[model samples]
Target chain A: MGEFDLITRYFQRPAKRSPLGVGDDCALLAPAPGMQLAVSCDMLVEGRHFLSTVDPARLGHKALAVNLSDLAACGAKPLAFTLALAMPGVDESWLEGFSRGLFALADEHGCELVGGDTTRGPLNICITVFGEVPAGAALLRSGAHAGDDIWVSGTLGDARLALEAFRGTLELPADVFAQARMRMEQPAPRVALGQALRGTASSAVDVSDGLVGDLGHILASSKVGATLDADAATGVIAAAASCGLGTEILRTCALSGGDDYELVFTAPPAARAAVEQAGKESATRVTRIGRIDAEAGLRIVDASGAPISQRFGSFDHFV
Target chain B: MGEFDLITRYFQRPAKRSPLGVGDDCALLAPAPGMQLAVSCDMLVEGRHFLSTVDPARLGHKALAVNLSDLAACGAKPLAFTLALAMPGVDESWLEGFSRGLFALADEHGCELVGGDTTRGPLNICITVFGEVPAGAALLRSGAHAGDDIWVSGTLGDARLALEAFRGTLELPADVFAQARMRMEQPAPRVALGQALRGTASSAVDVSDGLVGDLGHILASSKVGATLDADAATGVIAAAASCGLGTEILRTCALSGGDDYELVFTAPPAARAAVEQAGKESATRVTRIGRIDAEAGLRIVDASGAPISQRFGSFDHFV
Candidate 1:
């Protein structure tokens, strides 16, 4: 079948929520009246974003999931998305698996696949997701203030733990590895949590580049520093304790290993009750591991409140 | 600098027309109330869409222009776009040139660059553009009637002529080659013409994959056939006559050579005057080259009304 036919058969669906869908020059979406449209794009390249042996279905899910996480960070309601794909050649089985995984998630979120381009090239998936938010209600990275309590949804470092296992830098029991692999391959986007925290969270960002680095973005954008409770941060390591990682290794992975799709947000201390309510409503765990400060740089404090001096780097595509 | 820094410095601009711009996880755009969002995506891969030697600025312009053309065909007013780019390595000079061309066109159309991802990989550019159209005003591909006149804006075949010359299959005067190359690399998106033709045109599509192939989309969608005036269609060849192409070559190039980025629409005879007025207002030439028919397949008739049997193929990535 031709490329267009393949897309129509697999990716194109009756865009029930959109004004128009695939098979046209452009898809049409009408955001709810008085709402602003939130748009973001994310691209995944083979070998760079995923292992060569990764399942097509998981890859597809991850591709859309990452972009959706961006929407979640901004407290936008899932609306629609477009997928631009490039592949070395046509493979029906691969396409089937990929589309199935993609549509499954899209259906779950009601984010209809609208329109895109497919071409012959190295495998790359680029998705642009559209969502909606009330004017001035979006959770931005520039809104955190001094004395705000910083919170993260869900545990981090599991995806990084799985990556290390894949790279043979670490060893784990089969069941433990399986759980971590699930985190690596299919990290859940905190869309509900974001929407729930819309009014309470002063600033938010998804932890795609490790906790320390992603949080750095909030600090830089908000022009505030942070004091992280090292012991509380290390609580993420308990999820990986079955793999027998030492404290130093666990700390490194939790701080800088990357690939976690959790939401790290900030709110005033007085909003702690609202934040907890949001977490309960979203059915996601919330952990307060830091506090915003007026100082210009990040500081990690030990259990005794003694400051620790250690540098952590985030993943940069060109670095 | 890192990839994020590169994007901030080169791509991030104050989104004057949008609710929010590039720094946030999702860019927010609020179209005029009651307007539907028109969205389309196009990806250009180096070595497939353009030669490695093509100017970075033109390559960037073409990447966004092709997507803009899709919106134009839908009769939408350009609003905003997101760019997802992957490249083998970072080059500051190349990026400078590319961003210059990209922003120049974006500024002209008032389309803001919203948010996107940049990663390390083979050079590929995927742009998703958003536009606004009044409810039920979008020119769709399924609205053509059998008696409607098939019309094309601007011209065609020049881009194909340039491709052939680049591939060393044809010879041309230096000046002619330059002109054709410009047409190939920098074809203008007919945004103004598309908006002007909104109420008058029944159905429309941009001519990207040659006139025959793109028109086929309209015919297939509208469930109609067409009878083409071969002589008028071949008039596109006159523009390339200075390139020393033969009649057969000219006909093939004009009918099936892709990448022209012109608009092809169908209108009822009664709306011909309105179509002409739109053309005049947009300052673009519109040509009526054929008529939709109730027959099951496309047919070309010569000046004397004799049938011309020639098969034309559209450019397919897989084929």
Candidate 2:
């Protein structure tokens, strides 16, 4: 047994209990008439998720945003949240900026800041978000079906590329660099897209841990397989090429990087046009990348219809 | 600015925003429609909150119980929760016991297990609780009025006494020892008493950091003062005398030692009987030991009406 198993053992069986239980970003709760509650939590450690040098405001925003992304995954409308903050010492400006950024997003989402605690410790932030969804309708990763199409919202790998830029391993044109940094510093949680897909999406998950790995979640939960057309994903690179990003670098970044906070969802063949229409209505773009299959493995195929050998993995904390 | 202020500066002003906001155990949130939400969070460090040798099952129960105590303080009904756990390694039996204990209370309270994260680190357990109360009905620390009769549900000092025994600083009689340890290991959150007191009590708080200290929270929030009758509190010790506890030790433990998890609330003098009657209906005992006053200081008076002095402070993370 691993530590996760220990934690798992302590939890009630998710299957017989909650519609969505321990493993998801937040639980889908329908406690009363007409209203559904979405609850999610995320924790950011000092060294693991961010460097000490990162702006405190960005840290705070990221902490809340990560949790909000969970709500986005469930198509839950943001309602309110509590913050549990632990820090070794107080820094005024850092907190001001952090709270400013957090509240900016929260206010835009109509999320109320309710209750929380501030304690003395090494810096860490734990945020619990509560939101509401329509009763009897919530998106889940397990709803993907064979023959359904897979779609990803927004571009991927920009956040990862930004990290590489921060680490001095990657260089890009100034405009592309600014765009990559924006993807990292301020991620759009795909809330509108998720809400649009509430009735249409077969299965959905936010791509925080890279595209292939997160898409793997959909396949595993749906008990199906998938074949991805690399060119379709590389289309993001084609779009970035106008900003002077190398297609190869863009392809690698879009495929294997993490923390994009975009929604990757599956829809039935017939629902594709409707989904695209919904996205258009919301002024958001949707791109089709693959199709769910009856087989039991994931394979990425090139434009020539041959399997690509390049490996893909996402950010795993204890891997 | 201190680290707390620095971090908090980023957050928008919580004034008039939360019925109960930052710095409380759980946040009190008013969602749309019928129910208001009570939310609280607690984190237990490996060495600070408990010993590694302590039963993991008890630790899990206490972790959840402590947070529920916060909800209980606000007179809220339990709804659901999320747990964020960090541990170095997995121990199957320990995990089994822990989860069993956590679920036992959750089942009893009808609080569903919602969402959580499991990761590798030094042992820590952070649990956030969500509960509901009717709108505008949450018992707050700020509602006590001058001349209000202050009452406590259940006895106090048992948890602190148990800590003494656990540390080998004191030896207690067998039944007394068992009772105290049980108080420490499995605190009973006063959920029933809180719900029962909904309309009658003007102000309320749970005694986690000892009577004097926790009551001070009520005083500060309400901007009222209090005079505790030491003799009446001694009467509680006399009640415990049947269990073999001395009055002096009990008084000190009750006043300064923490972790009681009992609700200390204030009601108008005329409502005393109603409060007691409600307690009777719920089968949870209520004891009136003090009164809210117009002045702004805390005083503990002996049976003869003389002040008693003590050289102790409530629990502080940093001294």
Candidate 3:
């Protein structure tokens, strides 16, 4: 199919939130009064972001889900998104599966596809998502205070465990691998938890490039440090329990394993009940595994608050 | 350098307009009251949108320019943009030149770089640009009316001429080829003209995929037809005069050559003076090239009212 035909057949839809949709030179979206538009972009490349053998449907889901994770971090309501896709060729079955998975999640969040581009090239999926948050209400990374309790919504590090298993660096039984692989492929963005923590959380960031590194972003931006409970951190990864992972490997994956789309946020000690209420409200597990400090750098600690020696570097795309 | 460092060094800057910029998971942009956001995305793949031999700076400029051209078509004022880029590896010199060109055009248009993603892959540049226009005031392709005088801003098909020269399909003198190449590399978006023609022009579109094809979009969207003056269209190619090109080649390039990025608009016959005034206000040349009709398909004719004997097909990415 031609570019326009391909767009029309698979991607184009009747836009609900936008004034103008996919066919126009520009899509028009009007944020409601007292609302600010929250925008974020993510690009997924084959072999870098995903494996070549990945299901097209899951790839599409992960593409939008990662972008949605940004919105979740910001405590914003998703409004619309633009997907610019480049592919080696057009495969009808792949497009069908991809679009199905893409629109399924988008519809769940009420995020309309507003505008995008399709071109023939190496497989790449670039998505820019738009969301709405009330003025001055977004959860920013700079809001974390020294006395705030660092909380992580949902689990982490399972994706990285799956990656290591895929790379043959680790081994897992069939059932364990299946579960870990599912976590790697389909991560649920904690949108409800993020919104619930809009006013409660002092600061927030989605754990994309591992919890330690992403939390470090909050620390750096807020000019505060954190003392992370390494043992408690290991408790978040479900795969570790099934696979009988060792302490060192679990610590490594829990600290440096990337692609976890969970939110790592901070709230004051007095608001612990409020944070627990938010977790219940969103129906997502909330784990308190760290504490913000006045110190300058992140310090890893055990259950008894003793410092751990091993250093972990988070995943970096260019590096 | 790592991904974060690379972003900090080359892409991140103090955002002038956005509430939050690149450091965060999402960027926040608040539009003025009664304004609607205009968004569009374009993906440029190596060997598809541009030649690999082209300068990185110009490639960056063209990447943002094409997206801005979409905003211009809708008579939207530039706001902010997100760039999602993937490349084989990190090259400092290329990033320097690319960022230089990107920021130059972005600064000119007052468009802030809000947020984006960068990763390792085959070369691809995906940019999603945001603009704002008064609610219900965007010039849409569906706004055309029968008997509206079709107008084009600046010149068209010079980029196509340069492409033909590069492809060994046409010959041009050294100076002419240089001038055409500049047009190909740096086609300035008509932002000012689009803003000026906000109310004056009935309908509008940017001619990226040749005048005939792009104009066909307007005609199809408006459920109308147009009689394009082939002779007048031929007069718009600057390279024709410089190279002493034949009428047939001139017509073909003028009609079907892609990458022009000039505005093709429709205005009422009585709005002729207003159209001219808009062009003058924006310091752009306006040429009357056609007239909208009640019938449905685009009809090309000479100044003498005779239908052009030759048929031309617009450039399609996939054949």
Per DockQ, the best of the predicted structures is 3
Write model 3 residue lDDT over A1-319, tens digit each, in one string. 8888889999999877898888989999999999999999999999899998999889888999999999999999999999999988889899988998999999999999998988889989999999999999999999999989999888878899899999999998888788889889999999999999988999999998898889989998999998999988888888778677788898888888989999999999999999999999999999999899998899899999999998888878778
lDDT of 2 by residue, B209-316 (tens): 778878887898799999998667556531245655566777888787788888889999999888998799778879989999999999898778788885446775
Judged by DockQ cut-offs, the docking class of candidate 1 is high
Please state the Cα-based DockQ of model 3 relative to the true two-chain complex: 0.91
**Residues forming the 10-long window of minimal summed lDDT in candidate 1 chain A:** A236-245
- Ranking by lDDT, best first? 3, 1, 2
DockQ, per-model, please? Answer: 0.88, 0.13, 0.91
Worst 10 residues of 3 chain A by lDDT: A238-247
Candidate 1 global lDDT: 0.89
- Ranking by TM-score, best first? 3, 1, 2
TM-score of each: 0.98, 0.82, 0.99
Could you give the fnat of all candidates in order?
Answer: 0.87, 0.16, 0.94
Q: Give the Cα error of residue B161 in candidate 1, in Å.
A: 0.7
Q: Candidate 3's error at B130, in angstroms?
A: 0.9
